[model samples]
Target: MELKINRPTKGVELCLDLEKRSQWETLEARRTELAKDPTIDQRLSGGPVTEVAREITQLEKEMAAATVTFTLTALSHREWSRFKTEHPPRKGDKGDEALGFNEETIFDAVIPVSIVSVAGPDGEPVEWAPEKWAPLADEMTTGQYGDFKRAAFGLNLGEAAARLPKSLGASLVMARSDES
Candidate 1:
């Protein structure tokens, strides 16, 4: 299984290359390999674990390619304002600053994430979170945040990733932003 991960410093020196691969390749590889393994061999089910690993590698690569979304904290008054303007969540009642993730105002920086896996217990396949995700929280103090234990979190990463082409995660992100 080839995988690419997002490391701010490319944390790991060694890694696999799965470029020139498509979703169909991953989908087909697992399907074909598993179909051929009728016994569902423990060593090689080529199921979710394998598939998610492959895709996470791919996601890391894709997310790493992002020219934007770099993590920053301790911004100048101007930089902080600019960041807020760019990621505005919603409009204020009137004469208010745009709202969005303003973590920089408080925290050192928003952690740059690289989603690796979100599979099921069997590791067959499920909804996957993108490396760049708007996480949900239990409290509705501000934005829409989901918990890792939430039912929505149960969707395996594979299923989540498979929907990337259709921008399901994007939908979730926008909604999350609005909720905040």
Candidate 2:
């Protein structure tokens, strides 16, 4: 007898697990309620609420610094070149790469040049565009940009197979689902 194994045609997806994310909100609400309760202190309740509250704080911090994964469909070499040339790297005060521009700029440029998509909490893929990212990118602090830069670099480098590690890399993967 011959047995057949079914394989799921895997595809790249990027998005927060909605149910998991909702836990953060739920924790916040519980913390608020605990704070409002009277006689809910270590002295009376053996610090159960206090311990839970502390856990919530730690979880919130983790959420803030969480490394979100993004799947980017790279652009073609021709489009990549145009994007880099259009957004030339700015020189620093000492004629070096500008502060917060080198990696940050590259990551930001990747958005417009690539087809970036994210998944919903339900694991549904949602396509994102440069316009959707503009406001968030514009408001990011240098530290936040650093986080984004690292993630973007990893996504592009690994997915593009470093063919064009620099700004002008490959973009032919968009025609099909290819996850590196």
Candidate 3:
């Protein structure tokens, strides 16, 4: 019997809930503090810990309901290779070699190709395009953009590959490990 190797077509799903996420974080912090409070007995009915926990659970449901989800798939070997070749690092104005690939450039190039689908909070389909990415990215905070870029890269490359330092050499390493 011959063993067959399938291409990486499976998509990774990532969700973002900006509004409810902050509230969830605040509630989680309150729960942690309540867990340590001597006055608030965790085993007692209607205690602070239990109340905070309940709030957290409710907030989680709300967050899930409000979240925007993205589905991303890995690029084929040829496609990824061509992208890297097209976006090679360049020299600075002073003729110094660039330290690494630009994060924005990487995100801009990779995200559109990697995306399979996008859905809004209500599960309505959201239109996605390469042109839309820059404007959307501009509206996001640095942390938010980083999170999205990380997810996109992680789907196209392995998580380990995505997290690798953004050096020219690192790009080569990622391409070599495309099938992993």
Say which candidate scores most in TM-score: 3
Model 3 TM-score relative to the real fold? 0.66
lDDT of each: 0.38, 0.53, 0.68
Best by lDDT: 3
The estimated TM-scores of all candidates read 0.20, 0.42, 0.66
Per-residue lDDT of model 1, residues 83-112, tens digit only = 555555444423224324433231112222
Alpha-carbon runs more than 4 Å astray in model 1:
1-21, 28-38, 44-71, 78-180
Off by over 4 Å in 3: 1-6, 9-17, 92-102, 120-127, 155-180
lDDT of 2 by residue, 55-74 (tens): 77776555544434445554
Candidate numbers, best lDDT first, in rank order: 3, 2, 1
Q: Which residue runs does candidate 2 get wrong by more than 4 Å? A: 1-54, 57-69, 91-106, 154-160, 163-180
Candidate 1, overall lDDT?
0.38
Q: Taking the tens digit of each residue's C-alpha lDDT, what string does model 3 give over 19-111?
A: 777888998998888888888767797877888889999988776776676766677767776776666655552221342344436667887
RMSD of each: 19.4, 13.3, 9.6
